[model samples]
Target: MDNNSILLIDPTFDPASASTCNLLVKVGLDSFSYAIINKETKQVNAVFDEQECDNGAQKFAERLKTDSYLKLPYQEVKFAIHTANTIAIPNDLYNEANLESHSQFFTESHSGNLYCQAQNHFGFTTIFTLLRAIDKTLEEFTYAKKYEQNAGLIQLAEKLDGYNLLLDFTVASFNVLFIKNQQVVFQQCYEIENTEEFNYYILLIINQLNINLQETALNLTGIINKGDEKYHCLLKYFSKADFISVDTDLNQEVLDDMPAHYYSSLLALNQCV
Candidate 1:
């Protein structure tokens, strides 16, 4: 049974190219998505979204070896794995022994199953965690937070004038990244029911940062467009609201047809440190 409820795949995928392809995988709370990117052309040849299973992520971790949807040499595969863990510690204040202590405040599980990752920025160091259930996949694949990769793309936009707010969205959840002075100030994920709740969070972020909507530029990505109510609400408050385009030199012919901003996080996985 090769069927795993794939939501999408590229039409031109060549099975012979799997060895050289670089895969980007994200296992979320209730869904999993992956993009198969070509090494030479730097374009996605296939992308897949699968239905939630009892242990969906773990299944994906193991199924990559023999999943019916695609075929490849599991022993020599190259990939990047993404997670949304909220645990992070600053370098100046980080302690190896204290990681479990600090992380416990954010997540219920800080046991051996919890795997940690650290990223260092100029001002502070970020130490985050992942799951050990997927360790074998990380033996060669890069493990990263969707927030970090999404934030990197936003910072790369480099419009750091007052405050830059970048939002990446899914069905009922979203990740918000705040960039200032060419550096990341804060980034967080929230699940909101409606536009009002989303607006409330935006207001708090702006007020906390002491930003002037007249000056701050709010650029958006992921699952939102010009006509969407969420987009209009943002437009109403921030005079300079704009939809962020995927900033890359990837295959233009292949990506021109896709909504670049919507897949910014998936496409920018290679940018994570």
Candidate 2:
């Protein structure tokens, strides 16, 4: 599927899941939006958002299904139970030593595919020019660069192998694959948060596993409140750790048009490939 791509849309309207393992759909409950990328023209054929309709997805789909923008034959569509973001955890049992362990948390499910959601928030035809920039590179990061340097504060600082960490404060989710000698040794889900109990949960994993923090790279994908100073402060404690924000960049015009929820979906979509 070179010219065309298959996307598993997770259109979640409900906000129930809140752990690391459970599937989540809604990134920003109030922010609903959608977009149409024309692979042929390499532009956003159309865009829409929530304000357009009391119910966004159904309305947008009805309109597009009728007109068939791009005319590429809307191939397939299905709603999935999107998974929560994961993080590598550390042990808190040995407070003095700060040991680590492995465990997962999750969040609730959302409703509706984000594309249609985008349309609901922004006008369907407003961003036609910008959507053409929808290339894979724009959506993913093999290594973190475009993301703010502050986002990498943890990665720039930490060295933890066999230690566990939890992410509780975030609104997203991810999977942590532990690689040793260039091979996947283990994989687990982690939820990084600001709660003391969650922090202890991470330490519990470290202490119980009896692993050293000298050699570990924690991989994560999910929605992070970069605007929150609290998250930055907590990150300061994780010196010797590496962190990356995995998400796509909507052209400035698109960003201005879409709702808040689209950000995480974009991040999740970037990593999905």
Indicate which candidate wins on TM-score. Answer: 1
Model 2 segments more than 4 A misplaced:
1-38, 41-73, 76-177, 186-194, 208-212, 218-220, 226-237, 240-253, 256-273
RMSD of 2: 17.5
User: Candidate 2: TM-score?
Assistant: 0.34
Off by over 4 Å in 1: 1-8, 29-31, 49-71, 74-85, 95-105, 113-118, 131-162
Q: For model 2, how does the per-residue alpha-carbon lDDT over 1-273 read when each residue is reduced to its tens digit?
A: 112112222243112221111111121112222334322333233333332133223333343344322123232111111122222222222122221111112132223111211111111110001011221312321221121101121221123334344231223223333434332233334343445544554565456544455554443323334445434543544444333332234332433443343333332321221
TM-score of each: 0.74, 0.34
Error of 2 at 141 (Å): 29
Q: Which lDDT values do the candidates have, in the order given?
A: 0.59, 0.29
